[model samples]
Target: MDALPFALLLCGVFLFAGAVKGLLGLGLPTVAMGLLGLAMPPVQAAALLLVPSLVTNVWQLLAGPRFGALLARLWPMMLGIVAGTLTGSGIIAGAAARNASVALGIALALYGLVGLLKPQLRVPPSVEPWAGPLVGAVTGLVTGATGVFVIPAVPYLGSLDLDRNDLVQALGLSFTVSTLALAVGLALHGALPLAASGASLLAVLPALLGMWFGGWLRLRVRPETFRRGFFVGLLLLGGDLARRGLA
Candidate 1:
């Protein structure tokens, strides 16, 4: 791919990703990585997602009022994410980097299946102290390996029974930290070059535009409907990723 064409493709991808996040309050990085991984190596794709993911998710995290409470509750998990990312960054940038696309495919497929199932698992408050960090560590490892961060994190957060806004903000907080951690990991591994960083920064513009559009559409559409459609698309994309990886 020529530089201009690649940048254009990235703009389109981020625009769609931002729209998804704007409407649902999550999934920007997941969508970006999944789509971009189709054309590039997963590590490079992950690197490109850093700037837009961080910027948008920071907006999502702070736009709400429950930041203090969520942070208080989630600090341990956030700590674990950082630790896991630092620990696993080497694998992600080295041997595992080659297989990252396949891993991402598996992660996406699992995420879609779980979303479709919509199981209601309750987490006891007593278990959270232990479970939070465990889940965060695992999610961080997955993010390190595949550039997809949802996995157990989304379901675990849902298990907490937060209000809609709180859930959104919580996801934003988790993803913001994940993005920062990923950036550091990639930087340490020398995977983030100046050109990619510049392109990622430029991508912020289209992503924001798409977010605005999606936010507008969110008011008119049933979110559940859109969510179902989103997952279905993910399932198909996951299948494609797996196929390409196997080829």
Candidate 2:
């Protein structure tokens, strides 16, 4: 693709992804990677996502009232994510494009399935101390390998049964840590080239704009309806990516 066209494409992708995050409090990396994987290598796609994901997620994290509490509770998990991502960085760096696509497809498909099903998995308060780090480690490994970060982590968060505001805030905290870990992993693997970083930085504007627009829409739209639609889209998109990879 031509430089200008690719830049435009990045803008469009991030805009949509950011809008999803704004409206739903999550989905920026999920949406961005799923779309970008169709057009580029997953490693490259991961590189492009680093800046916008980090910035937006930090914004989300600070916007919440329970940051200190969430941080205190989730510190072990965040630390585990860092460790697992660093350990697993080589997987994505060395993966064949087809394998990476298949992995990403599987991650997305599973996430969508879980979202659609709305399973009532629970994490008892007593078990969270151990379970939290375990989930975060596994999620980090998956993220390092596939350039997608939602999975056991998101589901685990859901199982906490936090109130709406707390849940959103927790998600922001998780995503923010995940984004930072992924960036370090990519850099360690030398997959985060200067050009990709530059493009990712440029994409921040459209992403923020789209987020602003989505936040506006949140006041008007029924979030549950949008959530269902988003899951359906993920299922279809993920299935197609898996198919293409296997072909």
Candidate RMSDs in Å, in order, are 1.1, 1.0
Query: Which residue pairs in candidate 1 have backbone atoms (N, alpha carbon, C) closer than 3 angstroms, thus clashing?
Result: none
Stretches off by above 4 angstroms in model 1 are none
List, residue by residue over 1-247, the lDDT tens digit for candidate 1. 9978997899999999999988988889999999999898888888899999999999999999999999999999999888777666666577565577778888898898889899999999999899999989998898888888898899999999899889889999999998899889889998889988998999999999989999999999998999999998888898889878888
Summarize candidate 2's per-residue lDDT along 40-105 as a digit string, tens digits.
888999999989999998888888798999889888888878888877777777757788889889
Score each candidate by Cα lDDT.
Answer: 0.89, 0.89
Candidate 2 deviant stretches above 4 angstroms = none
User: Which 10-residue window in model 2 sums to the lowest lDDT?
Assistant: 88-97
* Lowest lDDT 10-residue stretch of candidate 1: 89-98
Local distance difference test, candidate 2: 0.89
